[model samples]
Target: MPETTPRGLAGLAFGGDYNPEQWPERVWDEDVRLMREAGVTMVSVGIFSWALLEPAPGTYDFGWLDRNLDLLHANGVRVDLGTPTVVPPAWFYRAHPEALPVAADGVRLEFGSRGAICHSNADYRAAAANITTRLAERYADHPALAMWHVHNEYGVPVSACYCDSCAAHFRRWLAREYGTVEAVNEAWGTAFWGQRYSCLEEINPPRRAATVGNPAQALDYRRFADATMRENFTAERDILHRLSPGVPVTTNFMTALSQCDSVDYWAWGRETDLVTNDHYLITDGRRTHVNLAMAADLTRSVAGGAPWLLLEHSTSGVNWQPRNPAKTPGQMARNSLAHVARGSEGAMFFQWRQSRRGAEKFHSAMVPHGGTDTRVWREVTELGAAVEALAPVGGTRTEADVAVLWDWQSWWAQNLDWRPSEDHDARERADAYYEALYDHHLTVDFAHPEADLSDHPLVVVPALYLMTEAAGRNLREYVENGGTLVVSYFSGIVDEHDAVHEGPHPGALRDVLGLTVEEFSPLLPGERVRLSGPGGAGLDADVWTEFVVPRGAETVWTYADGPAAGRPAVTRHRLGRGTAWYVSTRPGAEGLAALLGQAVEDAGITPRADLPRDVEVVRRTGESGTFLFVINHTAADTEVPLDTPGTELLTGERAAGRLAVPAGAVRVVRLGG
Candidate 1:
């Protein structure tokens, strides 16, 4: 797929989320026996066994882990060793009492939750630093260690902090960010609530869910919390640099998770040796496919387009969500390819062996019901064999001229402040933007704030609510330098401070897009508006319907409902040599698909040609060859026809021109680059 990580394993490591730590000596033998039965080659260990790793504080224990490491390496399997920092031990919390987090409702955390480290607390940082340093020193040169797994999922905390450390840090962060308290007060518009603080110590996060009508400290608290967690990550990474300089380290990032601290994928990507993430979906397949693709895409884009480790996925199915669903007979096979079809090189599950007891006891695993011989094990073997068959084509890179900019800081900024419209989740919008491109066969590269767009032929920034002046300037140069630009609704509504723009909704893009959004209408489920299309046929609309007028841009599509009908719901303007398309509404899949198709077509983007919709396609470029992965998500059997002739990698299913794609199956096609 896209060369998300050039410095990755030789081929996709086919197994993940192993807890050899959870099993006994006999069970380890059983796991290895089963692993050999399958072609399983890699394992991610030491995720949440803090209690086991450190039975007691200050005294390190490596006996159980040493044996565990020796076994994996002996079995010819590489291990992604997790640093037991995900959950601090029971004794550490008991001793240094201030490590707990203060909830958003201002409740001081008792030792009740799992990820309980207070980000801004010095005691917590020093203790965490010491533990990581020690752990790295112990395991840096281990034969089985492929990557260092840092703390799990650092999402923006749900509840704000009231602790003195967080407060002081917030004051310092604000002071450096805005210069003085007066600028902050002005930006937050604190005069309305009489909540202005005389001293920084008096400031506190919202205890209750504050209304959007009243500007609360919740948004800033969320930012500060994310920032603080970042500080923690940097601290640990710096410590690891001293202990394990060669072993690349990273934490598993949950794509849409809000509870852990993340301003954007790139926020941690900078510190991480290699970005690794998890993609779990129990939702509807139609939409969930995009969700999976997006998770992979985000992972690929985070480290400036480096392929990420597909750390954890349910080999069979997931145990969370409204329903803990298992993958259908052919679903697991299809899902594995789905990751590959969207730029992922490796695939792994949450648990290689099933848990006998605990919360994830019901989670699917490769080692099924009765030890060594089972249907799950058979399927695992088959999938592993597939990876081995296609091994020569792995670790390739993809450079799409289309770059889709996605930022986590913008997500936090948008959801933090009060707005007059519907509640919009930043992650969902980001997914929608990415999916729009994917639906049209556009292999989109995820663009972070610092991403260089010069390599891309097109750049689409959807719902960019946190565009700093530099980011805006980047867009301007990209468009002026001949890149097709697309910006969706709520574009340029706010400055970097989460404050509104002065003249119009799209504050920064007036120079590039040549238009300003005066007013917009919130679209509920069925409500929609249409814009004039090719044959006077209008574009479909739903979600967010925006009203727009051009300063110099030309209208491509117009809204069909309310007083704002016929206005520019979609507008295009010529800037320098390239073009910009501003879509001011959250049009449904059809509309988004069409818009992306047209934008790419206009920009001279030659897609994989006319491939089937159910069959997802991806291309990875290497010095020797170009690899194309075609996956059929359909439940019915089908044949695959190629637009460009290529050699089949997996099935030897020749495509001297023609290839067959079985129902719920996949084929990895190779061509000379």
Candidate 2:
């Protein structure tokens, strides 16, 4: 066996995607030398090299890869060998044109882009399996092999296909899931649309419809597409597990709220040997670091609080966004260490060298086109040394002070057509709630609706439109057991099948919230409402409002003016031993912070009020000791309170009482025993 060690690293795993094929053979020596200089321990190789690996059908070219792996191993760098199954070669596509994905409007997407394969096609599956098997067989015992990267970022670029092959595959999946055509019709609620199918053969993928398609049907197709992608992933993973016995297998996940929303990460989290995610900042004028922290926390939660890897991030700006502004000096290191503080084993970037020619030539890399003199190179080398200094913090887990409920399926349901208002975006609500908690300097762990909530002192349901009975019961039980809960509007209104819960609005949570929503009152564009209460004074809300009737709850805030003026806009209910707060309208940022502040007090959790704004503090504990990461995002120097004296990892200085962190810097302290 090559290596059974965790990610083939004794301490921290650090590096980027290494594409040796992109450069000349003479450059390989220099690349490895630079890698060693930067303290790179691992590099993901051959992720998009299918065309080069199998130039012609069934003709393999392992000479180049063999030499590359050998060279990496010689330099003491481990390899995350990829299966090369993401992008098929041109010859394979010419042979199987039907493998291309078709859009919802019946347009077949042409080749030339990555992730173009129709996952449901047999020919594509056979080709993928063959490539995966070939790579596994050849590198099973290679000394450089540490982990098997099955495919590069599944569900990106293309997820769902509307081709005929996918339609047939969808029918089979439905048959297995529903057992009968009648059951499918019932679950999909096809009776109202006059679209009930008598046989499974008559059904098809939710294709172009005259009007908006059935919400339930669209929802199921999302599930089916996600499962199909997983099927391909698991097939590749199984081949690697059998051929390469001790190596762990994983496919990178894009779990950020603004990124791929098709895959249910909770399910995918259970399938991988190790959970890894790729996060990029979407700089749209909002706080990018907050989104980074949220993505890192969500990824760690998906890993079941175990140490996960930051598989791929840009060293600076990304090319795909509308604006590709380069990061400021020292921002790269701060962004990287933030992830490490949230439970990432280490930080890795997109590519080792900035591409000279490609669709992503402008994308940032560790070694820019300016070579070793650029600011990016300086920060990259500095980050590498920083990672090495924090090796003692490896394997430690960050403890979360609160939990946020996140479900991709619920997000999918809310994003469908003909909703009350397009302004009611699920992703926006999630980001808002996470930002509120982050401003309070609270560490958050995202949980599935049905996951255990007993451990978290506080839980926030941002916006869950599709809630099953089990999840509702779970929340009720959690609150009854003394856990503080905060639920937002539009939650628990529908069941798993998109059917409205029978009786009152918010069907599943009416009892738990101690209030009933008689009707949804959505505001027109540019309209707003004022809220009045001790915590809600001068608060303005918009996008949505509800006519709430308090039953066994006390009114915390009332709509001072709007369509639902004087109605209970926010209510509080006391359950068995805990408290539940409900917000019936979207409040302004200050209002949200105030409401959450009350919930934190109710949970008996203290906020770090002494710390300045934008400074982040997180703790990671393990058998070695406790490590405190204080990241200063502000412009002025600030002092952070420390309970125990410890050695600062970065400067090798002994810190006691309180530590002064300079502006735009990160400090990791290894607490004394």
Residue-level lDDT of model 2, residues 1-673, one tens digit each, is: 3232345587788899999999999999999999999999999999999999999999989999999999999999999888888899999989999999999999999889899878999999999999999998888999898898888888888899999999999999998999999999899888986989989999888899888989998999999999999999999888988988889998899999456998999999988988999999998999999999999999999999999989999899999988899999889999999999999988989989989998999999999999998889989999999999999988899999999999999999999999998989889999999999999999999999999999999999999999999999999999999999999999999999999999998899988899899999999999999999974466899999999999898998999999899889989999999999999999988989999999999999988899888999999999889999999988888899899999999999999999989999999999983
**Cα RMSD for predicted model 2:** 1.3
Poorest 10 consecutive residues by lDDT, candidate 2: 1-10
Task: Provide the global lDDT of candidate 2 against the true structure.
Answer: 0.92
Judge candidate 1 against the unseen true structure and give its global Cα lDDT, from 0 to 1. 0.72
CA RMSD, predictions in order: 3.3, 1.3
- Residue runs of model 2 more than 4 Å from their true location after superposition: 1-7
Quantify all predictions' global Cα lDDT against the true fold: 0.72, 0.92
lDDT of 1 by residue, 237-308 (tens): 777767776667778777644434345556667777777777777465456666677677767777556556
